[model samples]
Structure formats: structure tokens, C-alpha cells
Target: MHRHTRRTVITTLLASSFALSGAVALAPSAGAAVPTASCTVTPNASGTSVTIKGEGFTAPRNLNDGESTVPLSVDANGNFQVTRFQKNVDYTVLAVKEDQNFTFVNCKVVKAGDTSGNATGNNAKDAKRGAGDGYRAGRSAAQKSCDVKATPNKNQQHSDAYWKAWQTGADAAFNRYC
Candidate 1:
């Protein structure tokens, strides 16, 4: 067979195999579909920013986990982030699965800001990661590891004062820098 003819035959076979497999139907020549936000959170630093540090994020979030209040953007990736939260705060994450609204709560100390309502279903691992060891608990009176409130945890109970102190510290750190 002619060399050029062999080359053409090889190319045709490769293309046919790809078409049949359909694993990579979208090639370099093809356009990649832009992924939209799925699961997210809003920091709400009120309006300041430095750099948000959460996974599966994009513009308009201004996350800067360092801020007091920032909006978070949730994606299908189920990504979570953490800041030095000293005090106890309330938090919640909303996820939409198949157009059904679902809320996950009772974990974060302060409220986790609502996503722009643009979040779709979240990845289980990422969503669990964002929850953060179950809220800041509180700064140990010794200013050590986090402290937990006397309130009942998913597994146990703690003192309210402990939680209060932790919450106070958290509020100060978050509100001040943010």
C-alpha cells in the first residue's frame, strides 16, 4: 500500500474508534462546556476583601475566608473552606438536588451565609469538608484548641460559657479583620 494511503487509513481508524467509544467526543478542536456554580457560600465581609480560600469557587464571591462576612459560591464539587474562627457562630448550607431544596445545618457555630441560590447538588466529600470539625466550638480559656458549648453536640454536650467565650473570640477576630 502507498505510505500516504496507509496514513489516511490509520487516521480514519483512529477517528472511527474515538467516535465509537464516545469517551472523548469533545476534543481540543471542540469547545469545552463552561461549568456553572453548584454549591457555594457568601462571606459577607459586609464588602471588603483580600482573597477567598474555598474550593470550587469563582468571581463575585470575594471569599477571602479571612473576612468577617463574605458570600460563598457552592458548586457540584462539594468543596469546603475554613478560617480562624475563634468564637461560636451559626452556619448553614443549602443544596438543590434535582430542583428539590435541601438545607444542612446545626454544625457551624455562626450562620454560614447562604449561597447566591445558584448552588446545585454538592459533592459529599466537599460538602462535609466545608462543615469544619463541627463549628469553631470555642477558644479554650487557655487560648488553645477550640472550645465547645455546653450545648449538645451530635454526640455529646458542653457548657454554654465555653461556647460563649469561643463565640466572643470568633466574633472579634472575624469582624475585626474582615
Candidate 2:
């Protein structure tokens, strides 16, 4: 074979291989659909308003029903984000599962200006990693049902039943964070 022809064929094959590798690298993986939230709360220096933003909720909600509240939005993925304003009062933000009519989780908002002392909900930092050990023992003993998974991970499968189990475990885990 001619040297130039051989070189051309080799280069073409290399380019094709590189292109295929790049395509595969950019493709989304089939097994990586678990939801996670990087939640954060930012209160203004005056404490009149607080910004709450995060991702990875079954649905985003605005527990506030008062006047002049900022609207929250969820992206294509099930993530919620909102900021609210009030006259230096604490806020309890609850993420309710609209379809299942259950509260998924609670967020406590204490604005910089808040002084009325109405804050509630567990702090995210104090939240326990697993609720099974303590939660299951108490619940199963009382209900006589051990069907629920004791330790429900944050990224577990999303379903009404799963959320119910998680809420059960969260009752105790929630207290740990606050």
C-alpha cells in the first residue's frame, strides 16, 4: 500500500475512534437518576427577607400564604427554590407532596431581622444519616408492623410508600438536626 494512503486511513480511523469516545463520554448514564438537594438559606442583613434555594425535592412548595411572598419555581428536574419576605418573623417551610398529600420535609427560616421567636423545624446539619435503628424499633413495636425499611437513605427511590416510610423515620431524625 502507498505510504500516503496508509497514513490517511490510520488518521481517519483515529479520528473516528476519538469522535466515538467523545460521544460516549457526553452521554447521560442510565443508572444515575437519584435526586439530591444542595439546600441553602440566606437571610438579609436587615432580617426582613430570606432566600431559600435548593434542588432534589419530589415537588417544591410555598407554605406561606401571606401577602407579597416570592414565588418558588421547580426546574425540569424536581427541584424547588424560593425567597420570602416578612416583617422580621420566623418561617416554617414545608415541602408537601401534592399528589400524596403528605409533608416531605420541613425547613426553618429565621431571617436576620426575625425576633418574634416563631421558628420551627430541624436544622439540616443536625439531621441524622439513618433513622432506622431508633425509629424502626419504636414504630414496629407499637404498630406490630416491621414492613418499613428502618434506614431510609436520602437518595432512595421516590414513591408515596417510600415517602411514608421516610417520614416515619424522619420524626426522630428531624429532632437530631435541630
Most accurate candidate by TM-score: 2
Pairs that clash in candidate 2: 47-112, 47-113, 126-177, 127-177, 132-150
> What lDDT score is found at residue 93 in candidate 1?
37
Q: Whole-model Cα lDDT per candidate?
A: 0.36, 0.47
lDDT of 1 by residue, 98-170 (tens): 3422322222222234332322233333233322222332222224422423221433222222223334444
RMSD of 2: 14.3
Which predicted model would earn the best lDDT? 2
Deviation in Å, model 1, residue 149 alpha carbon = 36
State candidate 2's TM-score: 0.31
lDDT per residue for candidate 2 within 141-178, as digits (tens), equals 43543343234444532322234334556444333332
